[model samples]
Target: MTESTTFNFIDSARRTVKLEQEAVGLLSTHLDDNFTRACQMIIQCRGRVVVTGMGKSGHVGNKMAATLASTGTPAFFVHPGEASHGDMGMITPGDVVIALSNSGETSEVTSLLPLLKRQGTQLISMTGNKESTLAKAADSHLYAGVDQEACPLDLAPTSSTTCALVMGDALAIALLEAKGFTAEDFAFSHPGGSLGRRLLLKVENIMHSGDQIPVVSPDTSLPEALLVATSKGLGLTTVADADGKLAGIFTDGDLRRAIDQGVDIRNASIKDVMTAGCKTTSPGMLAAEALKVMEDGKINALVVQDEGRTVGVINMHDMLRAGVI
Candidate 1:
């Protein structure tokens, strides 16, 4: 084939995007009592939501199942072909089956309808053809029909797949809102990701506590406090009173300021060189929250306290190590 430089690639791409956008926009018209009914069915399901489809629809169904499962709705995907191969036993009377078929006529998907109905399972179908067998058999049918495919030949499943994915997302989000699913709840389902680390990890969990905390007495010499800071490798040391209450904090910045002011580190007490009224965080605070405090205060470390008593210390490095940063 000869390269045609005059053929407008940008214009062709724009047309494809416009068509897909219109396809997704058309879904708003399909959002009626049926959409609400599907959400209600999934919400009331005692068993998990079972999503199934064929080919391209199957791929979209897998993603839909994942989204539902992560957002507080218990759901999983099963291919229609797999369902026919003894996987239909996974469906139950209490379960809601969401079947995706753009044409609503995929033989593999349609073949499961009789068994789903016989098992008394709730059926929700997403299809482009309302007249198709699957749509007619579904308890609640979501019209995912597009004006046309974005493909130049109008034979591909681009727009149809987008509409199905968006509809699935809408169902998942509506159910999530109705269930009052919080970010903490979502974190529990995604414990391996950064979101879980941010929501589930606490300051005390990763804090340097007890002997690991670099602490010095108010009367301790600045040089000795520096030694404690160096030994602990936290870049700072806390100066506490005889009662073990926080008096102040001396950081590398404070040491530099003291040196600039002509104070002798060997002779000066930690309290004299320390910065008073240092920022502190509670042990129960989320590590993510502690990072916010450090960010807002422009400080690298925070002394963890409990009821005005010094307990531990945490720094930016701790947040980084714990994957809370």
Candidate 2:
């Protein structure tokens, strides 16, 4: 390590990223008829898309398969080495196989071609070498070639692997669009995540309904409404009419304003101090949407109404507890 050859880590990192970035950018030109054919074949597949590769290509294949599965396509990864030792049983004639080989000549990957051909399984190959054996043997070949490796020796699979991953992402997104996958569909696939909770959880699921709701009749005195608000712990209480319909709401803000205006809290009814026709929401609405409604109105809670009748009440803290915030 001479002073002249200080080995600038930042310089090396920037160069590697720049090379990989260009590799990903150039992959667009390779999205030709072959890419479309591969997508069509997978779309028509009655069974899962079984991805197989060896070494570094195998790592990329694993992620590609995961992406496909999460994006409305049924897919999984199988190691090509294991495929030769009976893992090929996992694949079926109705399935489509996606094989990856950077040099397009991995022996383990190529060895399964005969068995796949015997099963009459369609093949889609992703390779850096267009003229390689694996590319020629496939039903369709997706070009993931890179001009140069980020590695100074031009040996390591750097830019080439990046391009393969980007190309696989392109394929998954295209299939997702073609299948008309919605956010709710994605939430169903990932039910345990925050995104799923935000998209799938409705206001009714986490609202305080029936006896849990803090409410009082419009003629109830302000002091009594304060007691209901405190007992329910929602910082506010709804004011209902004789017909059991929402009339208005009395919140902590109303109490503060009444004090500032020197109003009589003991004798004045909630109807005199309640804020009428305040921001309201529906129980069928998404909890995330309800959170937005609260945010838009700068209010801490919302009354859930159905046909102008109060069904439930939700607050910002409830949305937070449900992970809708």
Candidate 3:
């Protein structure tokens, strides 16, 4: 036999994926009242959701806890082995505990049942065997049973772990939607991530305000307005009326158009070569929203207005510097 034909790696992967897909698909059909009950239990908990498991289940539990925490339900993972070693103190009576164990009879996890019961901590179990001791002890049992393992020997945990992870994700999302979780709420939990920056960062926080803004009066000469725009390095300048209200905007593009019309910059007023009623944005608007405005209008900057008065200017360069782009 050729060395390449000795083991068909692609066939092995396909079979494993097929089995795991079937396992997860079956999970949806088996969903019952217990799933809803578990979500309710988590939502109503005055304390956080405490997840616990052993071995591969423990690894999955850690991710479940993180997803729940980030999605509005405060949760944390606790290893059953560590729980026996005093980390169990992390689980309070007000907390809901979700335990994962494919066999539903993991000694480390099952041993915590009596203690959790005595403390009145609600238990939600994800196990392959609904009749196992852990499942029977749980206030809510989530059956994650799979017909067969994706492993060639059917002895290794393959389909079971995938089912557990999917179940955890399902629970997190259900609770998130049930609680009216919003993008802003999610941003608060992930302030360091790009989505957080896009949602939480405001226009006022990064806009060029005060003296940094390039401004010129409508009567100012086109040559002087160009100097102001160049000095500010923002490629644009705002033309304000005598009362300090925005009258127009002069950009590099506007200068090009004026030149195309044979309007000499040396003999023109700033107003003659400027764009009237230019786009504007509020200081409170999100930087992400401002980017969209700039993109939609094909403009590089916006005059920041609050009640008909220009306060600052936000340009595409500002968006880029702030990582909003």
Candidate 4:
């Protein structure tokens, strides 16, 4: 192809994006009671929001449904053509339907309207034409109208579909705010991902408990504490009292200080040189919260305690291993 032909293709792509951006920008001014009413319908929906469209509009509707589901609104996509073929059974009286058609006259989508109505499902139409049959038959209508298409023939769904997607996002976010949806609530829906781990993985879950924990009595020698710390690979060892309560901690920092002072490592007791009043955390605390505590205290390890009794210990490395950091 000629350089001119390449430039023409690039220009077409840029024009398409520009047109869609303009459409989305204009959508803000169109936000009114209709938008609020649309959000209210979805917010009050007792069942999933069923999204349906045809062709390119269908693609946009599918994404809109997914976005709604991920962000707090329960929604799923339904193919209108498939609905006519027996998928209409997916809709129940409790569900809400969001139908998309740029011309407001997609036969496949409009064909399902009567069945959705019979099921007592609320219809929310998203179309460029307010006068279209789909819009007129809906309980509420969201106009995703674009002044023009980016297609050279002005027939493609480019700008119209983008507006519909943006409008869907607006509806989902409004409902999210209405429902007081929070990050913690979102995390519950995504428990297997990194966000879920950060929100749900507690320090208790990954901490070294029982005999696996590196703990030494206060009377233990510094050399012995060092050996335990080295063997446990936690870079530190908890020093406990006769009552098995945390008394202090001997860390690599203490080792460095002892060497600098020419202290007798084999003769000195761990309690004598250990850091007193060391930071500690409860097992019930979130691992992410524990990470923050470690970062804020500028410490790498924390002794886990319950009722003043040392139960376990966790280090920064442990947090890393558990994907908490």
User: Can you list the residue pairs that collide in candidate 2?
Assistant: none
Stretches of candidate 2 above 4 Å error? 1-5
lDDT of 3 by residue, 255-290 (tens): 999999999889899989999999999999999999
Ranking according to lDDT, highest score first? 3, 1, 2, 4
lDDT for residue 304 in candidate 3, whole number 0-100: 98
**On a 0 to 1 TM-score scale, where does candidate 1 land against the true structure?**
0.94
Give each model's whole-structure lDDT. 0.93, 0.93, 0.93, 0.88
Model 4 global lDDT (CA atoms, 0 to 1):
0.88
Clashing pairs in 1: none
In candidate 2, where is summed lDDT lowest over 10 consecutive residues?
A: 1-10
lDDT, residue 241, model 2: 87
lDDT of 1: 0.93
TM-score, per-candidate, Cα-based: 0.94, 0.95, 0.95, 0.88
User: Per-residue CA lDDT of candidate 2, range 257-311, in tens?
Assistant: 9999999888999999999998888989989888988888888989999887889
Tens-digit per-residue lDDT, 1-325, candidate 1: 4477778899999999999999898889889999999998888889999999999999999999999999999999998998999998888899999999999999999999889888899999999999999999999999999989999899989999999999999999999999999988999998999999999999999999999988889989988999999999989999889888899999999998999999987899998899989999999999999999999999999999999998999999999999998
Tens-digit lDDT string for candidate 4 (247-312): 899889888998999998879999889998999999999899999999999989999989888889
Worst ten in a row by lDDT for model 4: 3-12
